[model samples]
Target chain A: MITFMQISKRYGTIRAVDDVSLVVQPGELLALVGPNGAGKTTLLRLLLGLIAPSGGTASVAGYDVQHNGAAARRQLGYLPQRAVLYGNLSVAENLAFLAALHALPLQRVADVIALMQLDAVAQRPARTLSGGTAQRLGLAQALLADPPALVLDEPTVSLDPQSVASFKQLLRTLQGRGKTILLSSHILGDVQELADRVAILHAGRLIAIDSIPALAQRCSLPEQIHVVLAAVSGDEPELLARAGAEAHLDGDTLQVQVPLARKPAVIQALLHAGLPIRDLRSSSPSLEAIFMHLVGQAQH
Target chain B: MFRHTIIIARRELTEAVRSRWVLLCGGLFALLALALAFVGMRSVGLNGVAGFSRTAIALLNLVLYLVPLLALLLSISSMAAEREEGALEVLLAQPIARRTVVFGKWMGLAAALAIALCGGFGSAGLVIAVAGGDTSAGDYLLLVVRSFGLGLAFISLGLWLACSSSSRLRALTWGLLLWFSSVLLYDLLVVGATALFGGSALMTMLGLLLMANPVDLVRVAALIQLGGADSFGLTAQALIGFLRGLRGSALLVLALLAWIIVPLFGAVRAFGRRDFTA
Candidate 1:
């Protein structure tokens, strides 16, 4: 539903987005993860046609963003990072204006307001709402037109935990409805929980793009083996350490970071040690670890 | 495209109305018009100044000083504030063209200012008519309409400045300087120039100079219509002689229309070309 083809945006000497190409297929929930100055926002703005690309092209629903910006944007529901609304207008009024801009029926405003659960303060001025409420209002406006594609830039940045959970739930529902979503976020947990695929951008370039497990496999990060012993044993941590694992003893629990290929051998070694095992669990590398490993590798 | 533009325009208008900008500006104009009309009537001993032409002429000076300045400040501040508050970015992300955004804002603001001008001066004109005064309703209506044109010209200039400026502070600085040059300093500079260099070229230079400033163009247009050109001293008489009668008025109207079109076009162009990243 969305594609960025060799897109590059430059500000004099600074290349904000450098020859990046990405695509979000129909009903695919793609999360864009990067640190600050990673050009995630720039990439999204390029697709929105808010800023022209220095090179290459971007398209939404097969319409070139530069030449057919209005048509391209018609297929997109954008939630900006700041999500600022007109302070003087009420929540409902703001959404209604957006609906009118999209040429949607006024009924969409009411529907979105209800969907975002903004009924409690629908008539209140946007400026008076809390950060979470305002974020919800921003989401409501984006969802007002019922566009098939969504571009959400850090949609949950300012939300409380409860609101973030609800927002994630909303994203899941939208995904269930077959909306192609491209969301840029700093929260790896949210991305891990919702995204079907993750695109890692580092220093204006997309370094990696794949599913979490695939990325982990490609990065070859170590998996963590956690063992809770029934009793603490002297020299047990030493024995695990000698087996080429980064082993640490925390009270009665033994935690070891080992390569994925050596997990079976490590488990056999721990079993032959004759330690009473209260609990044994082997966990794959987390998305955060994979992200850090990827970004760290790119830095080197 | 037209629908999107109108929708954005309607939003701008609704925001102005909800924020009481319309009421505030309307009330201010009405109060000033009433006060000026009553004062002019008293000064003319209730005889000559009771007519609509005379009151409109009296209000003309006020409009020249107030309308352009108010329009510049209002339009510039609104644009600057929207841009600073990031509301403009939100609007631009919509499925609308950049030109539509600029034109919509201009139309909405122009409409609001028109309502205020009519309500304010229109009510004052009605008061003079109700009091059995010798009022030329047509002439009075013409004055109000021209004042609206003047407002639109300034609004367009203001939007041009707002669109080009990088920040609210910069927009305000440029707006104030433009307002000062056109409203307060343009006449002084013209008078000084004509006095220092008195020749056949002076009339042509003066005509071009007047056209350069929409405020002066509006003032000259309104004064000539009110038949008060002679009161503005030798320059007005000289201008009237050089350009002839009807042609001069038409030229001033044309100049005013250009003032509205050229700057608005520049604004639309600037808005369409600039990046909204910041």
Candidate 2:
């Protein structure tokens, strides 16, 4: 339910977000992953209408952000990279104020407070909250209106492991409830686990956007087959090449890089070639590996 | 829109109150006013203008000097910190108009500053009344109003600076420089102009100069209202002679208001168009 069409933002000579277009369908969890200065935050801000685009338009549920920003933002719940509440105001007060912005009832604030499990510190000033609690307070504010869409920028940056796990669970629940979630993050594991699709940005451009397997396949990334052979073999590379694979030999083991579809054939070919495979293990590339390959390729 | 503005405004005011920003500034102002009242009585024994008029006159320069700096630093630092710390980004991401955020912040800050100024001066006014000195409540109230007007003007300027600057330090630096020029350099320039010019031309030039700075404008207005026009220097007296009537009072209020409204309008525009990206 979120859309950006040819949206570009320029800071003098620098193109912060360059002619980028994206869409987040309802109930889908899309993760934006990028390095520093990769335009993730800029894209989010442009969609929030905190900054006007130099060219093109962004909309939420078909309401143009620039022209009807209030209405558009009404459908969005945004948690910034650094979720700052008024330091001097208590957690409940902060959530209540945000709720009032959407004309939501005080009951909504209480609901989010419970939803985020901030009941203990409800009366404490946000300045006194720990990083995880503070982040939870920020999440509480974002969820105050029960919005159908959430745009979170780096929501798990500094959270403790427990909090991060809880946050991931919450996202899953929200996704099940059909809330459109578009989160920007640097953590590959979270993206791998939570995202339905990943959008990789590199130097102000969308470099790749697809499911992990789809992206890995499109990039032709090599999965691995590790074989602890009975002894060191000199002809392993040539033998693996015959089976449409590449092999790197180290002592008594061979690491063969091949697609998952060809893994069984390669292993069978190794057997046919009279190579001794004492033990074998197969693995696929992680999201991080895929991310690096994509970003590294874009840089080239 | 109004509802959202009020909600934002209330949150800001709550922050100000909870932070003890109100208590600290209000207590300081009251202490300063009481000290001024006590000193003015002793000083008045020699000059023959007793009680509230003397205290009001003594408080005029103090208000013009201190209030603008206080308001500028408070509003500028508050706005700058909010933006620098990412609070503004969060707030603006909500379903509220940009202009509403700016206006709401300005109003909340304005109310807090007014409370402090009035509470401070009111306590001192009470002391003077209880002491059986000559008391003119109108004169003292007039001084408070002038102080608030001058402060409102500076607060507007501070918000504009905060909206336009890139960092908190940069915004605060701009705030301090603006306060210095308006509170210090502008007066010196006017004095130099008076020395360089002559006759009827000098009178018009000095009048414009007095109106050019909010501090000087409030000073002239206070001097005229307290019936102490003859007490100032020739430049101030000349402007006083030109602006000592109902029309002049209206002009002063209107000009002071323009000082307040224009910068606030600029702040709203600047904030509305600004990017919240670091």
Candidate 3:
């Protein structure tokens, strides 16, 4: 449960977040996908009350970010873009200090340690930890309070594949527990697999907000048809082009773009022309495709 | 607010005790204290100053120089390092008020300075006891009380220095300079100017210049404790006697209070408007 009413934050002459109003329902995983400097982190910080917005208002769980910041922040768990932890403190000690700050019970420290899989190195000082381990520690501290909402800013960037996968699994677990998660990331696959709903941002503005499937359709990219052929002669390319279409011929495989309404006619024409069609399938754009298309359109 | 402050204060004190640098520095101050006591006791026995004026003045100068130096080195970096490490944001994002964090940090640092100077003076007092020196219990108690006030003043000044500067290195530099100028250099300039301008001008300027350093008030407290009030002529002795009374303790208390309050007020004002993320 988060709301932004015409929230905009400016630094000097540039607006980092501009006139963006959106709501996140409780118990939803919302992915904020944007290019670099897209105001994703700014919007999150505004909600967390880490920075005061220059105009309008932001509220977390119905508490005004400016007026009731302390109370509002008590219900927020935030992992910032740069999680600077005390290098000399043990993983357990770091979590304990944060848990104490949140007034969490002392036992919750061990619970977070177990949840973050930090039990093995719980006594090890954080300076000796690997980057992924440190990232997990930061996440553990954020979640130690068991807050109602989580704002994780770029939690997956620079993490190894296994770490990324583990992190995704953790997010899914949190989502299952009915915690509202707003994850800002550049990794499309993670967002595609983990996000229940996605909000796309471009240069300090919200460009699109929808489910992944709906987002693909809104991108207006033609549907792609993957057709595997037994052979592609030189004249077959010209024939496909004369049919008001473009085709790429790759060693007995033809990937073509066709209108949804014209798919049947194109397939029939290919079949009648004596081309051996092994497979034909229509596919919507990938998340990457949709992201680039939407971001590109917003820039112009 | 008080609960949050206590929480932060406990955290700070725990962290400070764990730092090897603090432990080593505290050890060094203890060594310095012992050395000063040994040297002052021997010199006082030979010089035959039954009034103990010279011995008292020497001890006062040594405490003034060391207490503030150690306090500055220790406390000036408390918040700057937290800010640099981004831990300040994490701490602030909790339910704690900004002023609570500031006051808590100041108290934690004050506790650290207290333990440090008390350890140093406590060792000095022990050396005197073991050596069977010509000192009263009141002498040791007075020294401890005076040093406590001095340490509090210096630590508060350190907090102020840290608040005014954005960088740790700069805070350290400014804090050390403030201590050096006020403790050693300021009096040296007064002595030199008095020599150049002769007695009347020196007399005219000394009172205002002396007030420039809160450590001077501490020195007065120490001088009165050691029975050295009469050695510095009627004006200096009268000033010492005046500062030694209930009124004097009140002034000393006010100075220490300002040391803690003024800079803390500035820090809170600056911090509330500061862009902590930057």
Candidate 4:
């Protein structure tokens, strides 16, 4: 539902967003991940028409952002990074104002407030809310119009762990409801948990875009196998190494790093060695590891 | 578009109400107006400043100074604060047009200032009427309306400065400079210019120069309407004569209207073009 065609934004000599084209399909959750100054926010602003792209075009649904900003924006619900609301106004008042802008009925305000679990603090001023509650209020406003597409920029930046979990749950619910979501975040775990596909941006360019597992597969990074031994063995390391796996001894445990396809064979060889395997666990590469590896490779 | 504009305008008004800006400004105006009326009556001694024309004339100088200053500071700070507080970014991301945001803010702020001016002066007028003063209610109302126009002109100028400046401090600095230049320096410059160069051509130039500053236009308009033009010196008399009757008054009103529109147009244009990143 959202598309960027060769979109580029430059501020003087600095290119904030380079020539990048991306699409968030309907009912798809696309997470945009990048370090500081990777132009993620700039790209979002280009799509929102808050800034004119130095080159190319961005569109929401079918309307060009620059030429038809109002119509384009009508199809979008945006949650900005550090989502600042009117502090002096109550939560309900803030939502009511935004709802009025969209010409939504007053009842929609109550619905979103309840949906975001902000009904208890609806009458309180926004400034008094905690970071997590504030984030929920931000989500409430974005969900106010129930628009088909959502563009969330760091939607859970300041939230605590529990709040982040709840936020991920909300994203999952929205995904189930078939909403097109384009979110940019520094938290890769949240992105991995929620995004159907990940777009990795580095130095103003989109370097990679794929599902977490797909990206891991493409990177060919090793999965880790943790083997906790009942007792230490001098031959355990050699046995794991002979299986075409990198092995290290950590106290009474053997840690093996092998390709995903070779993991079964490596574990079978350890079992054949009769080392008395107390426990064996294999973990796929995390999004963080993949992201760091990708970003690290780009730096090189 | 109109609906969107009204939505924004309504929000701005609600902010004014919640902040009690309307109450504070209205109360300030009312207190100042009553004090000025009482002081004028004392100075007149036995003649009693009971007449609307005299009281309005007394209030004119105060309104000319206070309205533009208050309007400038209020508007400049409001826009600057919105940007600093990050509310402008949220507002811009809404589906409404940029022009609608500018126009809606102008409409809302102008209404708040109008309410303040009316409530303040209206209460003073009531005091005069109740105290057995012979003031004309219509004349007093006209003064209030003229003051409202003056407030709008300055508010637009302030918004233009707010839109164009990169930071709040810069906008505020420019706002104060504009206020000082127009309110205080403009008249002095006019007097100095006429004193240095005296000629019929200079008089014509001076007439045009007066129209260039909204404050001057408002001041001249109020003076002429209150029939106190003679007190402002021969140049004022000559300029008033050159403007000549209904045509001059209409031209002054038009000039004030242009002051409101031109800066507002500039603000909207600047707002529409600039990136909200800062």
Candidate 5:
């Protein structure tokens, strides 16, 4: 259980995180989405107790981040935006160092290395690894102690497609294991697939926090149905103007915004008026459109 | 805390021993000691080989300058590099106090320096004995112990600089500048100030200030080791007397403890409030 209440962080004149209040329930996967400088990193840091919040409180596993920082840290794992590990040490050595820090059993170090697929490069110096590999190593280090709550910011950003898929699968598995995960990413597709709920942040404010379906329902536009009439040509406008039919020509396709409840009546009127309907298609606003709408509204 | 310190110390010692520069420096010191020992044997004949004076002077001179330099090189950029690379944030996120991290790292680096100095001087002593050099066992032991004290002082000073800066280059520059000032310029200034004032109060202030500088304390102790403590000015004598009162293992431990404790405390305090994001 992660709780952030009335949190605000200021850097000089900029309010990096502004009056943000959020709760991540047990086993919940919360996705944080925002544009650049939208307080995603600051909020993560504040929750980790690495930086003090300008006001309010952040607690992890019932430990107040400010007053019981060590206790809170014991129950939390963090991956910073920039991972700077020891350059001279090998992957295994770095893992061992971190494991020693948390007083984890020695065997867990090897176990984490294998779980992160770092076995092949376990003996390699950290300085030699690529960006993606380094990021995975960072993740592996964070997971070594196996804390119940996780805050991963852009966990799959640097990974290849296969790696991203595997990582997403792993996240699903973790969710099933009852982990509270707060994953931050700019990509909506991942959020659409993985997140149980999402918190949209814009310019340091929490604009929306709800399930994708609910968010889509709230921000969704009205459905539009388009019926393309077969070529019975001129003077057909009067026929198409029958009751319950609101028709407009859009290139070759005739567009009609019909209530789903009134669809049968409109079709019956169109057929009775002798207007041949060549093809009919319904266009409903997708989650992408809803996200854009909400983000746009919040930006204002 | 002890476990953490030991874990850190082991890693630091392993890394320091594997460095090519440490090997090179150790080799050079051994060669220099061997050459000096051979010369001593030829000059003073057999009876002088058992005396404490030559070995004590050599160890004192070598440790006074080199230990601090090595300590500065090894540690001045340690925490700063970690900060630059963002590793400090990861480490701090663990269930450990910031001061614990600082102290553990300092202890680790200090352990490495102690080993390097003691090992280097021990090898030097072996070479001198092989060349039939004029140094008794008691004198050799004294020099080795003094080197440990000097090494502790330097390591602590390096840790102080490392904790203060966010950039390695800045830390290195500052560490070097301070080391140079404390070692070379501080005593000169004190002597000049005392001469200019010519009053007992001014003289005592100058005396206290000079004694406060670790390098001066080491230099005075070394002169005492070489039987010249009484030959200096009144202030220098007083400083040597103060150090001698704490002498043998007791004084050695105390001076080294002061060196280790003061800057270490400051480093820990500074680290507590540092913006680790840097």
Candidate 6:
């Protein structure tokens, strides 16, 4: 488990992380999302004990980050946004160095190397690696110790879609093994798919934190229902309106919007209206939209 | 702590070897040693190769000029580049103390420099011995060891500068200015100060100033040990009796050691206190 209790990091008058308090329970994946200067990296650094918090405390696996930093760090694995590893060392050498640092056996290096599918270019210098290969090496290093908790900041940024998929699969595997992960990213789709909880930070403060469904419900955001019809019916608009939905018709297809709770009633109404409905599709407000709505509110 | 430090140091040593830093510095030291020997021999009406004493004295000046600068640049560049390139942050995030990182770098770089100096001098010595350049190996080894000591002292200073500076460019700039001050500016300042003060005040100030720089400390030690004290300046010559004894030799050794330890301690403190954010 990882916990931050009222952590604050100040630089002169600017507060980078302002009185933030949160926890990632064991076997939970918490996604931290924010704008450019939203303190995501600062909070990660504070947790790693790379920088002391201006106030409060951070702990990893019950060890205080400040007082028991080495022990705390031993329980944690970190993958920075752009993990510029040792450029002169080969891929295997870089992994081996980190492995030696954590006192792990040499077999662990080969394991992570194979886990990340980095066997082909293990002997190549890190500086010559492609973006995807280098980031994989970074992940390999992070996984070398097989720590109980992992903190990955923008790990998938700048990666190709295939690599991102590969990375997420590996993360899923680790998650399955009960690793507590705090992932920071701008990619809300991944967070929506993977996170047990999403923490939205803005202007150095967490404006919102909850599961996507809970957040959407709390915000009372609308969901879209795309209705495909076999033939245009003049009464379709009136029927949707009568069913208390805000809808528009283009040809035989009707696009409808309603409160998430009202979705079932709209579908029932459409079926009962005797219209030749070819298909019906519903999309809830995306995490991105929820983020924007919340951040916009916080901004105001 | 020892394991972590050793691991880091070993990696640093590997980097040095792979980057050809060891070879580069080694080759430079060897070429310069031979070149100085040849130059010293021709400076007189003599040719072939100079004697051990003559070559040792010439090499002492070379050590002061080259070793410190190389050590400073090598160490500062390594530390600052790690910071800029995000290696330090990743390494620090591991379960290691900040001092371990600093000390590891120091030890590893120290070993690399020692190997370079040894290889350089050993190869040059082999060449010299085969050609009947000089018969005495003791003086040659002493010069090599002193040059390594000088390099260590400057390496510590460079690590301190790297830790204290906010950026790589700033660190490099500071390292260069420090090298300039240590090598050229300090001596000129002392001379100007001596001329301005003149008399008893100048004598004490000059004596203190001689001990203040590692370069000058090694220089005075070289002058005394190589029997050039009487032939050198009166200021240094005045200390002939005091510095020539066993106690003075021990004091000078301790002083050189202080040059290594003090700055290294500063580096550890600075690194621990500062943020390793990229």
Best by DockQ: 6
Which sections of candidate 3 miss by over 4 Å? A234-236, A242-244, A258-275, A280-283, B41-57, B133-137, B188-212, B228-238
Candidate 6 local lDDT, A159-271, one digit each (tens): 99998888888889899999999999998888888899999999789898998989998889999898898998577777889888999898778989899888889889988
| After superposition, candidate 1 runs with Cα above 4 Å error | B44-50, B132-134, B232-235, B242-244
Taking the tens digit of each residue's C-alpha lDDT, what string does model 4 give over A1-300? 899999998889998899999889999999999999998899888988888999999998899999999889888888887675788899999999999888889999988888888989999999899989988888888889888999999988888989988888889999999999999999988887888999999989888989998999999999998999888956777878889999999998888899988888987898888887789898889999999999998888
Candidate 1 residue pairs that clash: none
Tens-digit per-residue lDDT, B1-278, candidate 3: 88778877877877787776556656776676556655665665653122223333456666788778877777777778887777786677776677887788878877776676666656655665556454654665666667777777777777777766879999998997898798878888877766666455655566555556778767765666666666786555555666778986687668666765776788777667665554
Winner on lDDT between 3 and 6 is: 6
Q: Clashing residue pairs in candidate 6, if any?
A: none
Show the lowest summed lDDT stretch of 10 residues, model 6 chain A.
Answer: A76-85
Query: How would you order the candidates by TM-score, starting with the best?
Result: 6, 4, 1, 2, 3, 5
**In model 4, which runs have C-alpha deviations exceeding 4 angstroms?**
B46-50, B232-235
2 against 3, candidate with superior DockQ: 2
DockQ of candidate 1 compared with the true complex: 0.77
Q: Candidate 5 falls in which docking quality class?
A: medium
lDDT tens string, model 1, A1-300? 899999999999999999999889999999999999999999998998889999999999899999998899889888887775799989888988887777678888888888889999999999999988888888887888888999999999889999898989989999999999999999999999999999999989999999998998898888888899888866887888777778988888898999877778888889998989999998878889999999999999
Q: What is the lDDT of residue B270 in candidate 2?
A: 90
Per residue, candidate 4 scores C-alpha lDDT tens digits across B147-169 of: 99999999999999999999999
Q: List the residue pairs that clash in candidate 5.
A: B49-B134, B246-B251
- Please, what are the lDDT tens digits per residue for candidate 5 over residues B1-278? 67776666666665566555457666766665555555565666654343335756655665667767877877776677777778878887887777777777877776665566556667877655654544466666766666667767777778788888767898899988987888777868887777777556765675567457777666766677678667777765665566666454265456557877898888887777665543
lDDT of 2: 0.87
**Off by more than 4 A, model 5:** A82-84, A220-295, B18-25, B35-52, B55-59, B133-135, B238-243, B246-256
- Model 1, residue B250: distance off in Å is 1.8
Order of candidate numbers by DockQ, starting with the best: 6, 1, 2, 4, 5, 3
Better candidate number, 1 or 3, judged by DockQ = 1
Q: Can you tell me which runs of candidate 6 are displaced by over 4 Å?
A: A250-252, B197-200, B233-235
